[model samples]
Each structure stands twice: as structure tokens, then as C-alpha cells.
Target: MANFKLTISDKKGKSQSKELKDKEANVLVGMHVGNEVDATIVGLAGKLKITGGSDKSGIPMRGDVYGSARKKVLLSKGIGLKNAEKGQRRRRLIRGSTISEEIYQINCAYDGELKIEEAPKEEEKKA
Candidate 1:
């Protein structure tokens, strides 16, 4: 039973977030970065491409890395490192590219039209 928080982005730079659990969350397991998934799985109508994700501990996944294990890779300027001087490199802990049950958040890029309908606001009657 895995739970996941999905952050979906469209070509227009718009993004939406959704939470999935149990069976819905299980659909994302074993997927890797750059892989494509159906948006319908998350109640959307489009195709979603897997970009990246982070584990329960907030360790980000790197595309260069393989499998679903955490590793300490030497990074100069990347997702893990925020502010680094020129020619500066440091070993940072990052997760692999694969998605697993331990993953907490998954980032995706959506392809196709996305239209989200909002609930209508009610008007109060004047006394």
C-alpha cells in the first residue's frame, strides 16, 4: 500500500497537484523517469510523462541514476545542490530514477488538453 502526491504540469506551464493512495498509488510503482503514464489514472484526461520524484525522506531522484535505491553522488550544480560556487562539487544523497513504494511525491508533465472545472459559488438571498 503506497501513497503518492502527484504534481502534474502542462505545456502551458500550469500545474496541479493530486493525492493518491492504495490502488491508485500502486499504478505509479516501478515506473521510471521519462516514462509515459495515462492521466486518467489520476482523474485527468491526457498522457503524463514521468519527470522525477522524491522519497519519503525528501531525497530527490536523478535521471542519471538507475534502480530504486539511494546513493551519494558527487554533484556540482543540480537538483540536490542549490548554491554552489564555480568549480565547486560536493557529494549529495539522491535517490535513483525508478519509482517505488517509498516514493512520496512524483512529478509529471502532461500532454494534451487540460480543463479543470471548478465548483460554482452560491449567492446569499437578501432578507
Candidate 2:
């Protein structure tokens, strides 16, 4: 299995890092329904969910922050560990996925994207 070390950035161009399993990383590139793999977060419960934004069409749109590259970022619940609300009252729509975890969410930014290549893996020196 391959892993992607994603560098998540915020609107100001500041960045943070995280890792995702191979398949889950692919979903971010292909943002469509029925197109998430294991470890993929979906629906309105993740951090990448639009806490504040709207589609130009004037319709209420909320979901993952899909970008031009296959960067599967954001989260369901749009919920971050910071300033979070709990209980059944929290969800506008509830769906099941590992997406709710904090590991998935980086703070929202006007501009953020996943790094194109995996960081170099370390090699052990021979004794």
C-alpha cells in the first residue's frame, strides 16, 4: 500500500501536515458521489465541510473540499477539535465514516492543497 503525506495549508498560505492511506488520497482528486475509499471521510460531519461558504448558484452546498489535484482534504461534520459542538443535535445530516476524527481536518483556508509527492522514506544503515 502507498501513503500520501499531505501538506494542508490555510488561506494565508500557512501549512500543516498529515498522512492518508493510498485509496483515501485518491478520492480527493476525484470528488464525486460513491467515490470514497476506506479511511475516507464523507458527508457534512467533517472539518472540510463548508462551515462558511456558498456555491455561486445560490444553492446551499456543503461537502468535502475537493480541489484540482487528487487532494482528499477536509472532513465530514466539518467539525474540528477546536470550538466543537457535541451530541445528536450537532449534525445536520449524519453518515458513517472515520471522517469525523481530528486527523482529517486542517483549519480552513482560502487556499490549501495536498503535496504532489510522498516524503522520502527513511532507509536503515547496515550494521
Candidate 3:
């Protein structure tokens, strides 16, 4: 079971906080950095974009960098004797992790009416 405190603000600049538990909090599982979810604030709807958050394991979640060509180019330019593995390690360090209950803090940006929906379901195909 996971517990989380969500602080959201609507377009009107009014802010409110809510505590989510269990199934409600599970909606955030598997969401990577920058992913957006519909949330409700004070009976109003809004969007919650995951700007940054951490896991119960204390590992910080970061947006994927593999999609960035500039970062790849810069990573390839390291010039130290032990630099061979630095880029590899750095890549592993910046990627976000699968969500877990340990996530205590989640920061998000709220916007206009966001319709909360059930988290996407995973389906497996029989081979």
C-alpha cells in the first residue's frame, strides 16, 4: 500500500492538498518523469504533470535521457583515464524507476479541468 500527499492548484490560482492511498496512489505507478495524469482539486479537475519525485528506496526519478541527442554527444566527449565507464554509469543514474510506495513527495503542475481516469492496464498476449 502506498500513501501520498498531492498538492494541486487550479487555473484560478487556488491551491488544495489531498492524501491518496492504495488504489488511488497506484495510478502513479510506472509513470516516468514528465508524465501527466488527470487529478481533482477541491472538487475541480486539473492536470498533474510529474515534474519530479522520489521512490521509497530513496532513489530519485529523472526523465529519460536516451532520447536526447545532445546529451549523447556530450557523454561521448569525456576525456579522463577512468572516463570509459562514466557515461554508462551516468545514463543508468538519470533514468527513472518503476513507481513504488516509498515515494513520499511528488511535485506536479496543475492546469484546467483534468478528468481523472483509471490507470492503464497491462495486457499480455499468448504466443
Candidate 4:
């Protein structure tokens, strides 16, 4: 399993980092890092909750993007409204995407990094 580094920023403007395997990372890459997300009974959209993680943890994330799993959602217990606002809009799934595609989508939603690494030149094969 390849580990892709993830940087998730919470609503309070704090950011966290984590390493996800290809499959799991793919599913979360394009979602907003700190929004609460829940699954629709009919499977239309996932709910969004607060983004949570301790200051010592990397990418303190909460709220599952595709399903209703128990999560903290919020980062701070003392944080109150007016300082930040969370969104509830569900992300529309893209057509013809691999597992990586899901991560791509989540990152896209949160404006996550999708940098294309440049490939190094290699010797051509002689057939």
C-alpha cells in the first residue's frame, strides 16, 4: 500500500497532516477537511461535521465524507460560532474515477494539493 501524505486544514485555520493508503486517501482527498459529513439514507450525499484533531496530532479530521461514522467533527471545544462558518453542501461524485479519483475529488473540494510530479528521463527500451 502506497502512503500519500495528506494535509487537512480545519475551520479554525489550523492545519494537520496524515498519511493515508491509496484506497482511503482516494476517498477523502477532495473533501473539505473540517466539515461534518454524513451519508444519505438513499446514498445521495454525506453529511458534514466539524473538523477535529488535537493540536499535537496531524490533520485532526472528523466527519466521514461518504458515511455516517461517529466522529468529533470540531477541532476545539472552546470555539464558538461567528469566528468561522462550516458548509453543508454535499460534493457531487465524478464519473469514471478510480479509488484515487475519490481522493482527488476531496482535495479538489478543499482546494487540496494535486501537484503533478515530473517524471525523470529514462533509457528507452530496445524491443
Tell me the whole-model lDDT of each prediction, alpha carbons only: 0.89, 0.34, 0.55, 0.33
For candidate 2, lDDT tens digit of each residue in 1-127?
3343443444555555566565665444333322323322421222342122122222222334332222323333452213444532332322222222222322232223433455565653332
| Clash pairs (backbone) in predicted model 3 | 45-114, 46-114, 56-102
- Which candidate should be chosen as best, given lDDT against the real structure? 1
**lDDT per residue, candidate 1, 1-127, as tens digits?**
9999999888888788899999988888998999998899888887999999899889999998899999999999978888999999999999999999989999999997556666455653332
User: What RMSD does model 2 have?
Assistant: 15.2
Clashes found in each candidate (C-alpha, N, C closer than 3 A): 0, 13, 3, 24
**Per-residue lDDT of model 3, residues 98-126, tens digit only:** 44566676666676744445545565333
Better of 2 and 3 by lDDT: 3
Worst 10 residues of 1 by lDDT: 118-127
lDDT of model 1, residue 86: 100
**Model 4 agreement with the true structure over 3-115: per-residue lDDT tens digits:** 44444443455444445566554444343445444422112243433243222222222333333222334332222212333553332221211122222112212233223
- With candidate 1 superimposed using the best TM-score fit, by how many Å does residue 93's alpha carbon deviate from the native? 0.6
For candidate 3, the C-alpha RMSD (Å) to the true structure equals 15.8
Q: Which candidate is the best by TM-score?
A: 1
**Which one wins by TM-score: 2 or 3?**
3
